[model samples]
Target: VLRGQRPDARVIEAVRGVTFDVAVGESVGVIGPNGSGKTSLLQATTGLLPLAGGQVLVRSIPAFLGVQA
Candidate 1:
């Protein structure tokens, strides 16, 4: 290892300040402009990504089939 060196610690902000709910048997949708983090919000709710903060409540396990960029 190199002496007196620091590692890179970078972070990105995807989604923020989002809140909503759906009633039983109700339908819902998420819409936004491209690169607006529609997918990132979904990922956090489904557990595909670790949430830096906040919480997700669900009646059942989520299904994920995410594609790589």
Candidate 2:
């Protein structure tokens, strides 16, 4: 590979076909085995990761999805 040349990228579908809703004051949890994209789902929802397809609706003006040190 040439210097400074970007390598070919592979696309892996971490999360797909997932849909859910939390009512006002409702709560939920995501549980899955390792490599099952649990973190991917949350990241996508929180704007950390971009979604190939799908959308997230946040009622709060600013959603605190993660804590920054």
Candidate 3:
């Protein structure tokens, strides 16, 4: 579920009920095989994608750098 604007089409849920926290000095990694919601989680967290449920609070805005060829 993408966040703000409601889509005029069908919805596909990629990630669900994912929760976690990171401290100032903590480093977290997301690991999973293909089609395991890894990219979805990052997109939702960084505000590139809207969240269907729950909330995300970040100390600073996230910057998304595309993977270059």
Q: Backbone clashes per model, in order?
A: 0, 0, 1
Tell me the lDDT of model 2 at 9. 50
**Where does model 3 exceed 4 Å of error?**
3-8, 59-69
TM-score winner among the candidates? 2
For residues 1-69, could you state the per-residue lDDT of candidate 3 as single tens digits? 453454575566778787687897999999999988898788766667765666666655443333311
By TM-score, the better pick of 1 and 2 is: 2
Candidate 3: global Cα-lDDT? 0.67
TM of each candidate vs. truth = 0.65, 0.67, 0.65
Best of the two (1, 3) by lDDT: 3
Compare the candidates by lDDT and give the number of the best one. 3
Candidate 2 off by > 4 Å: 1-7, 59-69
lDDT of 2 by residue, 1-69 (tens): 011223565456887788677897988889999989987787767766655566666664435355421
For residues 1-63, could you state the per-residue lDDT of candidate 1 as single tens digits? 011123554445778788787788999888989988887787776666666566666544333
Shift in Å, residue 23, candidate 1: 0.8
